[model samples]
Target: MPDTETPAPQLLELARSLGVATEYWDWQGEHVTVPEGTVRAVLEALGVDVSTPEAVRLSAVELDERPWRRVLPPSVVVRQGARTAVPVHLPHGTSVAAWIELEDGGRRELVQQERWVEPRVVDGGQVGEASFELPADLPLGWHRLRARVGDAEPAVAALVVTPDRLTLPASVAGRRAWGVMTQLYQVRSRRSWGVGDLADLAELASWTGGDLGADFVLVNPLHAAEPVAPMEPSPYLPTTRRFVNPLYIRVEAIDEVAYMPAAQRQLLEWQAEAVQATNGDDTIDRDGAWAAKRSALETVFRLPRSPGRQIAFERYCVEQGEGLVDFATWCALAEEHGPAWTQWPEQLHDPRSAAVAEERERLADTVELHRWMQWVVDEQLATAHRRAREAGMRLGVVHDLAVGVHPEGADVWGLGPALARGVTVGAPPDPFNQQGQDWSQPPWRPDQLAELGYAPYRDMLRTVLRHAGGIRIDHVIGLFRLWWVPAGQPPTEGTYVRYDHEALVGILALEAQRSGALVVGEDLGVVEPWVRTYLEERGVLGTSILWFERQEGGVPLRPEAWRELCLASVTTHDLPPSAGYLAGEHVDLRARLELLTRPVEQERALDEADRAQVLDAVRARGLLREGAGEQEVVEALHRYLTWAPSRLLGVALADMVGDHRTVNQPGTDEEYPNWRVPLADGSGTVLLLEDVVRSRRARSLARAVRTR
Candidate 1:
């Protein structure tokens, strides 16, 4: 209909050049061809113009020639001890000299390699390519390459040397460590403002690591959400992964709060009491809590900062530089123009527009307020990390990194052009989610990322790993490739867009190595086998959920069969805890939501059979006795994990207390509460953090995996 000048074969070739997979093997082992329209839409989202045959040809030629047009690549990420050649483009007959400037202020001259190739004309000037070989003895850090071509100014590009394979910390070296995992928002304490805050996390980590003799306490992502009320409930869909959510900031924990006026303190006390009253409520109230907390925080924010505090805040602002200002400016603007920048006035849509610049000056105070909020969060997070390590935890707090940021949130608004516009990141059809999923979070344009030296991606990783001893990448497979669902299209119509894993994963490991932290990738759904091996080679652990770890004929995979480089767990957040899973709660939940492709009874029967096989395996391994109760089966399942040689064993807090509810139900938005479910025990009675610490059931489960 649209001039079909871009023929099917030509379109496929162009898509292939852009790393869009035209055909891929699904989870069902069937080859599925991606729709032509899907390819066109995906390409357009990548800023490729395929409207006309001439345009398509130009795009392809540009793709091949763009590198020749540059003096040096935007960035170069290479592993230590690996000799990689950097291509330096210059005017055909011009002479050049290149050298690497190490992060430690050292310099190394790069040796020129003989590269014989015909000169090509780019932009009416003949360009020649020269190869500079990187030394194998380069140190790991953020370095730069400087190339002086002819009489022009020297060209500079980012040159990063990442670790070849990250090694485990000495604290966790040679020993299998176990940890407790939970969604922190659901584990509210009486002291919190109707939700779990950083103070509560410190308490949870202190108790679990010191008392329970655990190595670490893993929690859900603390990524920022909208400042206003009616917040997005799912932590996985956040405003920005670069900053912490102010909602999780404990007001009383702020130092300035203690220095506030007496009358203001009294009013804050009353506000805390009002919000804490909702702690026992079945559903977690994010809107009410943030609305009240943000006001209380604002009062403390207004109090004059101590001289030392002021210096620290200013230093943070200077270190964060333009990115922080842009984010804060976007936040202030959102307060007036609304959260979605796309819906703002046309002139304000571009973050760099003159109108937005003027608006930033007009909203300077609000912008500073937002920046101050982040500084507070950073201090609180650091305190939590310090407490965890002091309590004898090997890895301290391991934070979860969500897959992507919200579509209309700060990242999309602040990051301008780095993220795709017309496509969203999602999942392909898998056994767990039959119809697939559209997460409504935009994917990064691979080309743009490489062009920008991956600054945004690196900034995100550096921030998340800043206070963490370890970080789990949600949907880690996304680093290699992501399913790109076109605008207004279902996930089934999407295609796989490949990413440069060699560079992406190398940068990830590089950041973790620099931070002295471990990396765990949630490589659970529809992952290619080679991808798992590649991750392991980089010393990044894979995630293994017991239910999904199956062997031949879909039977249970023996404990010894699980990979050692994995974080093995009996249950995950998406599914019910071990207790509820044993009772077939997941099947009943799907049936109720009408998410089943088969009859409810038939689905229940199949689930029962699967459960029986796993339980039987547990019994055969002598972890459970014959005719054991639900509690024994749950504990035994975890005890079953201990038999596996996985480096890290993850015990869910819900499974420990025999909580029967699922924290999230996939494929349903309004039909289920998803991430809003509070922590509860076996009888469906909600429990506070204080209640959980002294529970006998929890202690019993803790003992199950504490030793071998």
Candidate 2:
């Protein structure tokens, strides 16, 4: 029995603080249109019951700290400025202990211990008796208390301890690590259907970490995108960021598929050849590869799941419960909305409406299918992570967390009210583009994220960390500020919106320490210099590209000056590969495309001289033979990167094979074949994974940096 009247202003404020840009929401209406699938995703994020008719409420309710579980690491809460007892709800027949862990100068010691009896509540709930104490002498920061019953057991009825306040210390050190970047999709493998998958990632990690003695391998985001016919090719513009794309799943490695009946096996095996066709020297056909795998998975899922498989699936379902439901709902809504939900039906419009619940129940099968896909993707991703670790990767499975999701995608749909509908995030006009660029994706409001305690951010981080040893935060400057273009406005009309830098860095540090994963920010633009210093103090690493690692006076900083914690790469997704850079293909392409802001001839002349100097520097470092040619000079540049003192180095998959093309171009989408090209060798043919590993180029590069 909840009130159905208009939500209070405070609620609206909460929504706004959480990045909600709308005062009211109607899912099916014109003003507040959201893809049906996106609505479901929002609902799922809030842990709403899809089958239930009641409109699920999304609120963070405060209550007396209660014991929610009775396992080890029992949750507890700390009161502000006082050592006190706050009664909390608990499950019946659960044992608990309460104690506070105090921190002083980086040392953690337990204090203020108290035990309590289980109390019976009149409202048919159990409560814990007595309160825990806090030290008056403790300095301010996040301190936690634990109510525990068992060691090494899942938490049962424990209260969640949250400190009332904290004062961050000033002298935080910059990270002392580094990583390399790679494009998995471009990292073609012998076994891959057409594009790279987790298997290829595992292989790269093994070589880079075990052989090259690198700390981490940074990479492009692998977030799930719209799985429609003729799928959107760009990895940056994903359908959903919370889930992995099923297209990247390694089907041949599935345990259930391996145990399938002979007839089923034969049917799946028949499709392997078609899937393997892309593994040859051909441009990647993403749609064809996914089509084959999707068909195969549907059949594999149909066969009765084994007990062990059932257990795993059930566990996955439980773990991904609300998130899965929402994604599925969005998938269905995307179908109903077609191109955009802004033009969808009125009655079924609002994400929090009863109409959505009804539609969700009516379209149960479709919703379930989306959930199944997520489960499979999660499973495969986890398997890949495990394999990378087992293969002796020093820091396995460094994942790429994209800067933002597509405007019409799941994240935007779920937080429509919070996200500004008319504003799209992008970069200001730079030397490269006279007319700035608009990414067409909504960005989170800084104030909104703070008020919400960064729950969405936290949840997304938790999810991504599941299959990663570290995470590369793409476009890291977004955490400090973002260039926002008002909807319908030109990119040039955009203004910079500032973010909560302190909170952003704080939460990031907290999450990183919690996950035991290193944080590398892609700080590669006209960023505020203090931003890097701040990130460093917080133990977060900055991205350092060799091409851009120059001092104030146009002098290149020595390798030792580069921070060890930062990731050093020769190029990025938007840049040309090593071969292309050395061969002057990028310069030629830009000149041909008229992308240069300066005179074409002048730009070309300057670029040629710059390229020559870079090659000369590589040769001087002994990275190349004295008389090395252009391609060999490119190899030498890579050798310089691999041997750099930086902790992590990302060798783009394209660079590993001497591929020249850029995987993605920022300004031009259709004008240039962005994200659609394959990783090719010299002579312009696609390079197969097996063939790549067997090639002289790969061997030469591998041998050059096989320090470990």
Candidate 3:
């Protein structure tokens, strides 16, 4: 156990300087102090040495002195169309020269805006601070700042210029648009091999956008998972945010498959058919589907690429550069050793070791195969986006970006030292999750991120936004702060860590602006009030769930009272679909799984009261009729959502088919089939894409929102 005794002031100051919270208020409204040992451990993971009082004092002094020592700070982010002053540190009375290099190879001179301040003693020398003014009209992109002081080496720092706000595209600005939200893997069609793929996504978009007059289709994260069997089912925990999972690829959709020899193609077709046999099963067989798909993909990879195809592939390789190589190499290594890189031989653990280089050479073929798989997925994603646009969707495909990457995954391994060690990202205990929740994904060290100019984060956003018309950032509060839970500690013992929201959010807005895409932040559950206001001020839409919109007396807030800058929905994946929620299936499932925090009877009573309030609200609006069944109530709820002033409204696909199962339960993993549940009706009948399009329930729900 960590020592809870009084901590030295210097220790607390050092921790604060490193962005670790020394104390925080818990959900119970009580002040809780972080253990001294926990703080030290977290600091160490952040690469700060605070093992003793002397070390803490020394670290504190270094923190104050380091910024002054550097000719220019490691990185600086300024909002576009705003003139900002950047500080420059130099020896006392020394003259400095500085210039800005734009992203397009253009250069501009910066003017020193302020006179030098009085010199201060630092490490036996006097240092002076002065301010330089940056032009207000600098283009939005990553730029460079070069500075020189006296006879010293030229110092260069990254200067990221970003937009002040993310604005909606003209195509979607003046209209109230409705869309469908779905877990793509669970929405398998008759043509899919057990698991839904990009091809199905395109088809669904075409049906909804073209036939139903929907404007967008929002799907769960398609981020990459481990390349091997026993794949991680949760899309929120990914191996790499920069790449898409090849498991979601359609085998027959690749152009090269058409040119393959007859025998090989027949074998692949047989495998696909056999895999498709599981489509009607209650749960998806991810491992089986992946194995069969992998075999077919292996065959497809053997077909020689045509000249034009080869040129495109090579261009992609060059564009991706070292990042792709590192990720592909990690995949190949996982194939040989296993998914957990920590359990591998010591020499192979370090990505830059000579042994890894030799191993990369030995496994060059496997690495290339992994790279080929990425290219295939990228092509399919582009096709899906194109299809949505062709079908007249405004914000065609709104992709989800998961919060963080898995601990033993590609990003952590490849971007070694950039990610903090021995800590996980999670949430504090709340009413919904009494024990709090810990997601075993490592977070990026704030210091390291700034040191590297947030390149990894930039690369990830750029990649995901490449073919997306909009993006939903899951747990978007993470941009401002994240709960850093020490390894081997309960989530209740975690502390909040602050991030540079200005830089982070500014970069996000810049990227969205450049991509001409909309940004919707999932700002639900225990978020600071200021964060939402900030996001709204920046034109980033927030997420609003119908059940949680309430006033002080627990009365459901009226539809018209809800925030206009939101994507309103009746339910989320974390809860049961509207049909099941109305039936109290969530309570029953929790009871069965031993997840109830109170007695089942009491819990059900409270749930009933909550349901009554929601129904009463709908009844008052005349949207619900007397003795309405779950289907009618579901439509009524959606109709209520349409009444809100929100620009974008979402209708879950599961609700359209009256699926009774929840896509995920917050605190439990193996206790329930979280992400594996197929889209099913109230009677537990599996519903495929074809059934969804033809179902009267789906069309009725669509009509409710469209007519509203």
Error of 2 at 697 (Å): 2.2
Score candidate 2 by lDDT.
Answer: 0.63
Error of 1 at 551 (Å): 1.6
Write out the backbone clash pairs for model 3: none
Q: What does candidate 3's lDDT look like per residue over 1-708, in tens digits?
A: 656765578888888887888998876678888888778778888877887778888888888888898889889999888888888899888888889999999998988875647778998999998788999999999999988888888789999998888889888899888999999998799889899999999999999999998899999999999999889999999999999999999999999988888898889889989999999999988999999998889888889999999999989889888899999999999999999999999999888999999999999989999999999999999999999989999989999999999999999999998889999999988766767889988988888889998899899998899998899999999999899888998777778889999999999999998999999999988798999999998889999999999998889999898999899999998999998899898888878877666888998999899999999989998999999987889999999888899999999999999888889988788999889999888899998899998988888889999977
The per-candidate count of clashes, in order, stands at 0, 57, 0
lDDT against the true structure, per candidate, is 0.90, 0.63, 0.90
Evaluate residue 51 in candidate 3 and report its C-alpha lDDT on the 0 to 100 scale.
Answer: 77
Rate residue 555 of model 2 by lDDT.
57
Question: Could you list the CA RMSD of all candidates, in the order they appear?
Answer: 1.8, 11.5, 1.4
Off by over 4 Å in 2: 1-180, 206-215, 336-339, 619-626, 642-644
Model 1 C-alpha RMSD vs. true structure (Å) is 1.8
